[model samples]
Structures are given as C-alpha cells and as structure tokens.
Target chain A: MAISVDYVVRETATNLRRNLLMTTAAILTVAVSLSLVGAALLLRQGVTRATLQWQGGVELSIFLNPDIAATQRDAIKTQLDAMPEVRRVAYVDQEAAYAEFKQMFANSPDMVESVSAKDLPPSFRVVPRQPELTEIVGQRFNKREGVKEVVYAEDMVETLINFTDFLQNVIFAVAGVLLLSAALLILNTIRMAIFARRREVAVMKLVGATNWFIRVPFMLEGMVQGLVGAAASFLMLVVSRGLIASALEGNHLIEQFVVSSADVMGTGLFILAMGALVGGAGSALAVSRFLDV
Target chain B: MTATRPAPTERDHWRRQLLLTLVAVAGGIVSLRLMALSVARERDVYLVIMADGSRVRSASYLVTLWPAAVALAAAFGVFASLVVHTYRVARFTFRSDIEPSPTGELP
Candidate 1:
C-alpha cells in the first residue's frame, strides 16, 4: 500500500501530541546538555583568548645582577644569541628596564619612586626556536656567572592553562552524562510512542504497510526532538554570547579575550547538526526493533 | 561444505543495522570536526614586545604539533564509531518477532 505523505505527517503529529510530558522531558534534557556544551565551547574560547594574552606577556626572562659588569652582560647576551635553540635575543638595558618598571607600577607612584634605573637589573628577553625546549634551555643558565636567575615567566600562564584543561574536562564529562540521558530519554519517548500506537501499527502492518511506512513518522519524531532541543540550546548560546567579555572588562592590552559572534553561531550549528543526526538515529533504532514488518 | 542461506528475518535485521551504523558514522564525523577546530586554535601564536627590546611569544608548537594529533583523533573517532555500532548490532537483541508498533519523532 502506498502511504501518503499526509498520513505520515498526521501520524507523527498525533504521536508527538499524545506524549507531551515525555517529549518535553526529552527536549529539556537535550537543551540542558547542549547548553553545557555551548558553555564549555565558550569557556574554551575565553581561556584561549586570556592565555594568548598571558603568553604574549613573557617568554623566558634571564635577569642579571643589578651591578653586573657591562662585559658580563654582553657575554651572556652573545652566548644566548649563538645558541641553536635560541630564536632571538634582545638586551634590556637599565634605562629601558626602569621605563618598564614605571609602566608596570604606574598606578603606584610611591613604588615607582622607590626604584631607580641602577636598582633594576639588566636582562635578556629570549625567544626560543621551539617552545617545548623553553624550560630545558632556561634551566641551562640557572647558576651561571652573570645571570642572577632565569625566570620561566610563562609558568603562571601554564598553571592557568592546566586549570582550564581540568575545567573543560569536567564540563565535557557533565555534558557527556547529560547527552547520555538525552539519548535514553529519546529512546524512552519513542518506545512509549510505539506502545501507545501499537493497535494502529498492528492494523497498518496487517494491511501490508511496509516497515518504512510505519518507521518514517517515528524517525521524524526523534529528529524533531533532537532538533528542538538543539535549537533551544542554540538560542540559549545566542542569547548568552559575550557574557565573559563583559565579565572581564578592561583586561590585558592584547584584548584577545573575545568570543566572536561567529563562534556562537558555529557552535550552534554543531548542536543543531548533532540534534538531527542523533535524534533520527535513536528513533530509527527503536522503530526498527518494534516494526517487525 | 554446504553453506546455509541466511533467513529473511536476519537479512532485515542487517538492513536496519546498516542504517543505524550510517547514522552513527555521520554523528561521529560532525563531533570530530568540532573537536579538531578546538584543538587547532592552539596553533595561533601571540606575541608581545615590551618597551625594552625583549619579546615574548606564546604557543611555540605553532609550527610542529597538534594538527597531526587532531587528524589522528578524527581517524580514531571514525573507525571507533563504526566498530562500536557493528558490535552493538551483532550483540543486541533487536529481533523481528517483536510486535508491530511504530511511533515517530525525536526527543
């Protein structure tokens, strides 16, 4: 028997309307889980932006004794410049160091007044050819003659990054659990639909209705649930975009701590796609099982 | 040795399983793309030059890492989903003898 599109549409509608509570539960679960996913994506971007600024602040700093001989400073500079691991080396003379000190403590006039050009140490700001080799290379000059101490300025950023990684993992875990719940909810809704319409389904099968005929409407139901949940999540993200930007007002000079409109929309698109695929897949599986055509 | 032909019910089960597997693979690919985009952001290098001649650079692995790892992960996701779906289909008790019932819609 040729099943009309109208019949299928009506059946799907009836199935959805009949199971209002179950459908709502499924949708809300999907929305919550997807919202977490959206939040996680935004968090990652915020961390990336903030880290970029932190990373821009310093690489490896080698401070010299404030009273080090000019010859000693030059020797250290020359040695650093020649190393194959070193990408570039720049010397920070006393006057330049003083200027930076003033800028860094610009808010505190008393602090700036207490230190002078002579008190600040001349240093070499070294960029490594390979980032991974930074610690090992910095470790080389720990107790050397002219060097007072080598500072891995990026350590502060590294700690924050590790924290961000841990946080993202936690968010993903929560989202994973919610996603599983959403899947089970979808499965239950479909099963209930099958149970509710078993009489009609049996009559349709007896009248030679193919499995595809019985299955299409149910698969459509699953897709709709996934999509609506995803759409709800997409809207949530859209509404909440730039939350971090506002929260972190007037931050680092790099100003890269932004979650652009594109990021939200892109993540929204992903949630939508996932909703459709997972939504249909679950119902398809459930429908096929009970179809028995 | 004479091989026995598979029953029609078994063939129908295979058809349904194939459809579900296709859906799983599609879901896997989409998820993988999102993950790759996230990992690839690490390639951007942020640079800062102070009032002094000293320069600071971030994300040093900009040139030599991450992309390969992301690609490997994508490959793994694709293969894993297919294998997992196959396992589920083989082991699950989705028999055709169950009662005729059909409901449509996700969620």
Candidate 2:
C-alpha cells in the first residue's frame, strides 16, 4: 500500500502526543541552538559598527618646526596634498594653532595667558582617502625637512581590531560546545522513544514489516519535534533582539548596534530547518540498530 | 523439564529509563546553548576581532545561531536512533530464552 502524506502526518502527530516530554525536549534543543546563532550575528554587527567609526576618525598630524619659513610650509602642504592617498590637507597656521591651544587650555587661563601665536608651531591636519593609508602619509611627512613630528592613530586601530577578533573566537568556541551537547541530548531522547516503542517494532517485524516502513514514522516524529523546537527558538530570538536593541540604544556609544527585523526572520527560518534535520537524523540513527538486528 | 524464560516487562522498564536519560541530556544541552548565546552577545566586540580583523565589525552580521542549532538537533536525532536501535538488539538477544519464538519466526 502506498503511504499517504495524511497518514504519515497523522502518525507523526500521534507520536508527538504520546511522547510529549521527549517532544518538548527536542524542541527546546532547537530553540537554544538557534538563539546562540542569532546572538552571535548581533554581536558581530556591533563590532563592525564600532570599527568603522574608529577608522573614520583616523588622521595624520604633521607638526612643523618653529623656524620653518612661510614659503617652505606652503610648499610642504602642496606636496602632501598631491599624493593619491591624501584626501585633504588643511594647514593650521601659527595663529590658528595658538588659538586652538588657548581654547584647549581655557580651563586654566594663567597657563595660556602669556603664550603667543609664534610660540605655537604650524601644522597640517591630513585626512587620508583610506584609514590604512594613514601610515603611508605619516611616514612621507616625517621625512620632510620642515616637519617636526608625524602622528597617525595606528595603535588605536590595531588594538580595536585585535580585541574584536578575540571576542569572535570565544563566541565560536562556545557555540561549538553547545552544538555538541545538543546533539548528544537529542540522541538520548530519541533513544528513549525507540525503547518505549520496542514492542510495537518487534510486532511489526513479526508481521514481516519492511525496515523502511517501521523507521519512517519514528523519523517523521523526530522531524516534527525539531520543527516545533525551531519555532519556539525563533520567537525567543525575536523578543530577545528587541530587548537588547532597546538597551543598547540607551547607551550612546552603542546606539547604532541594532538587529534588524529581516535578520531575525531569516535566522528563525534557518533555525527551523536545522531543528527538523537534527530531529529526523537523531531518530533514524537511534532506531537503525534495532531494525537491523 | 521446563525452561524458565525472562520477562518482557523487565526489558520494557529498562528501555523507559534509557529514554528518560536521553531526554534529560537533550534538555540540558538546550539550556546550555541559550546561556552561551546570551554570554556571547555581551562580548560582541571580541567576537568580531576573531572573525576577521579588517572586518571585525561586519563579522556579527555574518554569524548566526541557526547552523549550530540545526547541527545539534541533527546530531541528537542520530544519537537517539543509534541508542534505541542498539538497546533493542541487545535486549532482544539477551532475553531470547524467555521468548520461545525467534523474532523473525513470529507471525
């Protein structure tokens, strides 16, 4: 007899009800797994935003000597600006630089009251087309005869990148362990289901039921369990994402870190698929030995 | 002389216990995964750095919990199947003396 889809569906439903606790366990497994995956994605997004913000702030500072000639200063600016890596170079004349210093030291008026514009060195605030090119521009300016010092914010960028990398590795490692544990757990649950139905299986064998016929229903039951678990996980991820985004928005530093709606939905679907596959595979494997012997 | 046979009830009881154990393990794994994910979120910056230095910020967008969840679930299903099948074979063979009719011989 050809097995109807309705028949398979009914059998799966009945099995689910009969093994309610196991079914629940399977679903929970899927939910937890999916949640971890979702959280990891969100964490990555936050790091990306922070890095981009930092990179945007990178600039080359060229400090000029106190004795540099006006004509030489202008020439240096023109040379630096001509480089393809150089996006823009604004010269901060002695007067302007001195005003900035005074403003910066405004909290202590006495400290800057005697200082004059000539005492403050002229400099160029050089913006680069790319953050990575900051080093190149800084090095070039450092070799110039009239430049006193060259500073590029390379240390800050490197530190941020290293820190982010360490975090990703840790997350991935934890995710791996969770996945291993989940598999083992599902394995045990399906084993129990098979054990409970051993008599039924023996009877089917007695009646000459094919191995495939006996295994299909249990496999279907597992798939259903996984699907349910994935659904639950998806819902939880959505709620958690909203809560996290709200909390992050309150912090100005992390306000840009938000998990979009589309991401949540996409992740949910992926989790559901995973749950079903795991459940089905677990059930099938658990029952295989019994069928063979 | 009559041969004393082992009871089917004994096998059934043992099988039930095994299934319960499996369910407990699966539940524990699920709980652990949830906890891990929560912890991971708090350390997002570090995770990005590890994924790719230049693209650390973008790494979060690429990472997803779905693959791990699905992988775990699939692994569990296979484990369950293996455990159940193994138990059945062992139980049947061990108690064959109680069942006068061989499994294949029964109608």
B1-107, model 2: which lDDT tens digit per residue? Answer: 99998755534533543454354345434433432443244334221111011212312322533333443454455346544544554454344343223342223
Per-residue lDDT of A200-272 in model 2, one digit per residue for the tens? 7778777787787778888898887777877887888889878867876765444544557887777678777
DockQ of each: 0.04, 0.04
**RMSD (Cα, Å) of model 2:** 12.0
Clashing pairs in 1: A217-B104, A218-B103, A218-B104, A218-B105, A221-B104, A221-B105, A221-B106, A222-B105, A222-B106, A225-B106
Off by over 4 Å in 2: A1-6, A62-76, A79-87, A92-123, A129-154, A205-210, B1-107
Q: What is the per-residue lDDT of model 1 for residues B1-107, given as tens digits with 9 covering 90 to 100?
A: 99999644433434443343344334433433443343345434443333333544444443423443443454345345544544443344343344443442122
Model 2 residue A268 CA deviation in Å: 3.1
Docking class of 2: incorrect
Q: Top model by DockQ, which number?
A: 2
Q: Cα lDDT for residue A8, model 2?
A: 76
Alpha-carbon runs more than 4 Å astray in model 1:
A1-7, A17-22, A63-72, A75-122, A126-151, A242-258, B1-107
Window of ten residues with lowest summed lDDT in model 1 chain A: A169-178
Query: Which digits, one per residue and each the tens of the lDDT, describe model 1 over residues A1-293?
Result: 67788988898788789888767866765676567656656656655665555565356988887778888887787788779988888888889977976775666688668667876667788888766778877988888887777777576345345544554454354344445544654565566567666667767877888988888898888888889999998998887665645754764322354578888888899889878877788888777655663
